[model samples]
Target chain A: MRMIPAYPVRSVLVLLAPCLVLSLWLGMPSLVHPATPEEIGLKIATEASARDDGFGNFTATQAMVLRNKQGQESRRQLRVKVLEVTDDGDKSLMVFDEPRDVKGTALLTHAHKQEADDQWLYLPALKRVKRISSSNRSGSFMGSEFSYEDLSAPEVEKYTYRYLRDEPCGKLTCTVCERFPVDKKASGYSRQVVWQDKDELRTWKVEYYDRKDSHLKTLTIGNYTQHLDRYWRAGEMTMVNHLTGKSTVLNWAAYQFRTKLKERDFSKTGLKRAR
Target chain B: MRDGAARYALALTTIWLAASVLAVEAHAEIEFAAWELSGRVSLESRYFPRTGIDPSHQSSNTNGFVLEPKLYVEDVEGRSVTVLPFFRYDSADPVRTHWDLREAYVLLFGELGENEWEVRLGADRVFWGVTESQHLVDIVNQIDFLEHPNGKVKLGQPMVHVTWTADWGVLEFFGLPYHRPRIFPGQGGRLRFAGLLDNERVEYQSGAEEWHPDFAARYSHSFGPLDIGVSVFDGTSREATLVCVPPACNPREISDLSNVLIPYYAQIRQFGLDAQLTLGAWLFKLEAMHRSGERNALGLQQESNATELRGIGFEDILGLYREEEYVAAVVGGEYTFYSVFGSTADIGLLAEWNYDERGRQALPRRQPLTLDNDFFFGALLAFNDVESTEIKVAFLTDASRATRTLAAEFDRRLSDQWSLHVESSSILSMDPDDIQWVGRRDSFFEFHLEYNF
Candidate 1:
């Protein structure tokens, strides 16, 4: 067998070294320039917000059961109407139907992407409309565990997020993340941790921490169903307040999408006529 | 009870029964399914710590019950009608054993000139004011004075109201064709100007009397955080100050010195403006009014003929009979603190200044300045529990008069259809500068039970 001279082989290797190094340097950016955790979180949020667009309008009925620490429970029933708003978040109206004392009570909310939302409460007894202050958004809703802020649809710009990790959540794999409210004064919670399933990118659970940074509440969402083959909504949501040992369960049913509701249907006049 | 009263009772019962049946039936033809029937039954008992001002008081206490039944019907085409009847009975006073059709109206809405237009025709009540302490600017409804001293109750006014809604503001035009006489305590009632109001001696500035054709217009709009309202009223004043030949308050009662207070309804033109500014957790409110022809007892005395003024104890009932023009305003605000007491409760502090530039009242001498010029401070605490319990305390004081009025109430819902309310009130007065509550100035505790359906 004939062998090339060792010196010649060495010379060729020397000639190729610089070229290999140059090639690797040119390809490094594509593999190493991964998105930051924040960028990934924002991407997920933006995707989620965009996914539910074009629903136009929808209506649904809900039943809420509130349980105090002593295990005593009371139930309330209401109907909700929602209208998709462009250049903003969404508009919604809630009218209570049962619990005679509060019947004919209605609430109107106009959510915004970058500003505090607008809210109005119509109490039948007074036959008047009262506007809720923006700073008071964190107050309890109708004496329930939920708050006025919680009733509003989540907007992408209202929060800053950090992607935490991927983990198994029930039957699906979820992308976990942490969110800090952009306007602290309007939120009762200092921070929140949420888990969103990867398949449909729908939120499955959220953990809220009070201003003191202690765990205050846990919200679990389940029984999700899709409408218009695109929009997804949970049929059941349960919120348990660890600090108070109280829990509220909301069960939504009979969701009707693309109801052709117009802006007029969400006006103050509509609120007064909600019955 | 009179025959007419009994007839009204029977008719109301039958009507309510039919409405209940319709509300239960699902017949789409008659549109019964679209009608809603609702009502309330309440039993309230008042215990006075002392005998009331009723110089003729037979009892120091009172037990009352009210049945308010309402029905709303909507046609398939969207036109709607509402009927609300309020029936109340009081054991202590015959004047309060009455029933009123608080609201019976038909509403229609449509679009006109790119603006949504709505009109209501029939007997209805319209309130216009921003003050929590008094309804100074609410002049549309004839006050039900016999019900409560603070003037919250009202008698329905028959009128046609048209509202034009635009993005900029809401413009309302009102045509009140008939006037309803204000109710006052009878001879045997606890609170009375004299012994009773002379129902037959009432006078009206308008020649049309109770059939006066009154009109008003209003414009209201909101800009960002501020809401503003401007209104003009030209009509017979719903507020009737009285004139007596010799006041029932006079120590020496005369056979010719009529004990009856004669109501005088003045014709006037009024301009009003109300504004509210919304800030984070705070709301600021202001209400102002300018009137041209309000009756002033002092002004009247200055114009009275010598014979009419002879031997009259004018100073004792000073501001009761004159007519004057003036301006008035009320300014206040409410501040709320969230999550009070480490619970899901919110506490709200409210303060208000009620000022009548003239510092006037009917029969000012006897009326004093008890509530005319006062500072009102109140607090409301709300619990976010399942029952949504709440407690409110309010105090009104006029430092000059050295008089004060305190009102407190506690409310809680026992169930979906039952509720309990406990309320208490007292007015303190002193000397020749007597408070109008006078003999009726007893501390009152009320226990109220209600059922809603």
Candidate 2:
């Protein structure tokens, strides 16, 4: 119950209150300068996808360290090659390189935008290539916390987006958005919440909601480095499966962009020979 | 003699290990694309709590070891050569000690017509069926009897494979040149009959015997949710028909004879269709086959046992009265419930109903030496963690015999390269008269420690 100065102070405060309220309300939404929330989400997603175009192909080596609730750890190393397809989704091949039981194991993927992706697994022990059912994509990847759907590259057409909010996440201003998977039959998730920075349009964090609408996993990306001065690739990505009390950390190194990768390299014929 | 073979196998494994290590060291400075060596060595112990029916296996506890050394070499053009030599030594069963060249082949893969055609030429092992309990349609490789009773292991088959992939689907052809024979237990093995199977008595319907030519063709395609594969094979049957000495034979002659069962390989043709549909977490599968000239020379119907010979004693050679054609089918499904009982582990339940048209087992259990209609149910709880711990439980029941075979397995990864496994299996039959059949074998518990290198 502190009393205001009657004449000058009250009049000045009353005059500036509406202007301050209007500025606060209008300042946040107009930062990115989009028309609607959905528009903003689509625009951001499109920008992210567009910003990553014209890299041709890339090859990367990664180390995956898995840990359980008891702090027990296991490690695996693999090489990944991705080819950019203009009309359809990308074609990628992953070859395992460590832990003798699974050494020389490989997976080749031909992702499509509309239909289920075709995937083949070459088990070194069996010495044959096996085609896995795309609809049965909920199995763990190499017994890790990551599922097959989680390891796949997320395409722009794979999800429908809606903007949630704008907030400052750590140092960067991030736009929170919700996305629903387009292929409801194959994807194990019902929806996902993504946080991408406004400056680089790179994903900072994501929360996965499982088919049962339960919060299942959380993925955080960090230590990003710009490749070819345009494409942003995260150096470290950690995925924590909340329900399972297990986590997988992927540390990527030696990313070579614009590598000469052909369609033959991703075919099933080359799966067993991949290294 | 067993000790000598064991020592020789051990020395061979040691020599291969040393040579692989030396080769790796020699190529240390060069790029690793030239060659890579990887393999596994496991030591296993089996303990039978119950006294075995077979007096030959008097020792309840036994120890064994297996060394599988595999080498993969790649040329600059991506053509690869895989050499895997497997050796196992089991002290309890002298016949189980053996060595095999599991894989020694050069795989040449190529694509033509703008990726529309692909060919794979090599000696390899191929598994064709999708069922978890039994593989009803797999016939490419001979069953490795010592590996497991469930027929999950195989011996390599020399073959050429070619596939044509187009907008319609994939059409594949296989030409099998070398047909290998299945090995049965030699005298001292468990789960075998009172006497050993005399390989000398092996008769092939085709006069060519083991050198018969086999060929297979398959067409696979996907129509929406359903994936289908239709296959046809012309070859000697992998399933062997038993030729036994009549029970009326004199004890002196029986004592003189070493064979309680003689494998008769029949020349047959098989047409099969395998289909699977996946919708959400449910998987429905079916496998159907019709065999022409199946058991055309067999003696029994697989369900009846006669203490008295049908029309003759030991004077007449026992053979099928006429040519027979039969069909078999298996229909099953798997339903998975994720986060079952509010836990992170997933539980899957599978059911399979197998029907054999030639099998007639509606009456009481008088067991013969062939297969019959049955049902199987299996469950798997996978704890996908850093350890990848899992437990599998399954049971197969023959209603006519009122007997069941139950199995349970637990596997745990101790470390990145180390693992421990325990498995138990038992057979229980309702009919006391069915004591002398396949499922009547004594139960066993197997434990193993494996180290992957």
Question: Can you write out model 1's per-residue Cα lDDT over B1-453, one digit (the tens) per residue?
Answer: 222433433454345445534543444444433888988899988887776555355366789999988898987646677778888899987877777777777666776665777777776677676667776667777766666666777766667788878888888899987777766666555655323566656678789987789999988876767777899999898766656555442323311223566667778999999887878788898988898787763223333433354466634343445557887777999899988766788899999887776663433211223345778899999986788799999888874666776889999999878989999886664433332434435567888899988
Question: What's the CA RMSD for each of the models?
Answer: 8.3, 10.6
Residue B86 CA displacement from its true place in model 2, Å: 1.3
Where does candidate 1 stray beyond 4 Å? A1-32, B1-33, B193-195, B199-201, B246-258, B297-320, B362-370, B434-440
Docking quality band of candidate 2, CAPRI definitions: acceptable
Q: Give the winner by TM-score.
A: 1
- Interface root-mean-square deviation, candidate 2: 3.3
lDDT of 1: 0.74
Worst ten-residue run, lDDT, model 2 chain A?
A: A26-35
**Model-by-model lDDT, in order?**
0.74, 0.70
